[model samples]
Target: MTVGPKARRSGLPARDRRVTTRRVREDQRERSVRADVPTGGGDVGVATDAEAARVQEREALRLAHRVVDLAEDRKASDIVLLAVAGMTTLTDYFVICSGGSERQLGAIAEGISEGLKQDGYLPIGREGSPDAHWLLLDFGAVIVHVMAWPERDYYGLEKLWSEAPLLLRIQ
Candidate 1:
């Protein structure tokens, strides 16, 4: 049994209800639906869903760092991360790091290659060799390049793709 305003009109309560109805109507009239609707959470600038995604990418980079640390820890030298923006913007980031010797470079490349594979990342392709002074591991979202120090300098990947976003740098 709903109480109609006519049935219970003491005066104050009915007026209050009318005021609330009017305010709601006014709000609806003023509000416009946005084209870019937010998904899953708050606004991106305000520590919401987008920020959380960036944090996740950072964590992924940290996992990549384990590969870097493994290289450094194994006596390899000079870790470099490069971001390569894809031709169609499909691939957003890249990582290029290097080691000391050809053997160590191979080890570093193998570590990154295996590590990324175990983490469920399939490389598009990989090239070069530890003995060849450079090794490339191509994960779709990011690429890992392991090179000897001199070869890294000679190619200068850092300068080549300098405009891409640098997500992490482990010296």
Candidate 2:
């Protein structure tokens, strides 16, 4: 039988020919494996678009809850979670809560930042002033608003996002 140039030059015996063929087949098999499979490098499981959206929604909801819990822990009141996944492209969830005073608002924001930091999450942007009536923390998938009662009432976020479903409310 005719062997390839490398094999012919190596002058390998018949026994070695069988080993080389097996090695070549193994290499081909490895190369042909699907790319979707996770390679244990922190990649989540492969999913279709719909599945990916659902996963993101689930994660957003979890983050929203975490924000609510942190705010509540800091004595924030009138906590509300709005699921704006389908209604708005800006963010998946909106976590709205009220702080009694400017000091409380700062405390609430700090609590949220420290809490989310434990999960390796940092806000992409923070708007409004901690000393002001409203402070917003944007975490990409979730946006948290720590507002004073008057500001929340005047801004009417609930009215603006009325079409969005209310996922959770903590009085």
Candidate 3:
């Protein structure tokens, strides 16, 4: 039953009906714009350079910690995490660990790769080789070094980047 304003004024009985009005005004969609560049002038959603850098730092640290955890799961020895963000522009963190042997080095590298992949992250590049007694997994924000005992001692990464803050170390 319908009861429109005009229907009651006409002294007519209400009738069952269904009606939908047309969009006579011709609706138009608003144009899209970047939030960082506000047209009306507002301070919302605009991050300063320092704020953006801090966010990046947090993400890099998280990735580094996860890599260290994965290496531990693979029984990697002498695991050391270095914060090289201030020292270099190459990567934010460096996770160096000893795998004891060439086979173990491969395992450690594979474990970190597999673990991070589950979280939707994959190494941007890989360098060296398992047979070479070392492997490098480049995850952009984090760089992992899976090295054999001899290689790790010879490379002396800790000595090379001694200035970089040692964030974590697990013997």
Q: What are the Cα lDDT values of the candidates?
A: 0.59, 0.80, 0.77
lDDT string for model 2 (68-127, tens) is: 889899999999999887887677799999988899999999999999999877676678
Q: How far is 24's C-alpha from truth in model 2 (Å)?
A: 42
Scored against the true structure, residue 156 in model 1 reaches a CA lDDT of 89
Output the worst ten-in-a-row residue range by lDDT, candidate 3.
22-31
Summing lDDT over every window of 10 consecutive residues in candidate 2, give the lowest-scoring window: 28-37
Stronger candidate by lDDT (1 vs 2)? 2
Q: Which candidate is the best by lDDT?
A: 2
The local distance difference test score of model 3 is 0.77
Q: What's each prediction's TM-score? A: 0.55, 0.72, 0.72
lDDT of 1 by residue, 1-171 (tens): 112556255445665666665565444322222223344655433344555556545654665565566556555555655444433243435556767677777777776667667865555557877788877765544556777788888988778777766656767
Question: Which residue pairs in model 3 clash with each other?
Answer: none
Say what the RMSD of model 1 is.
21.9
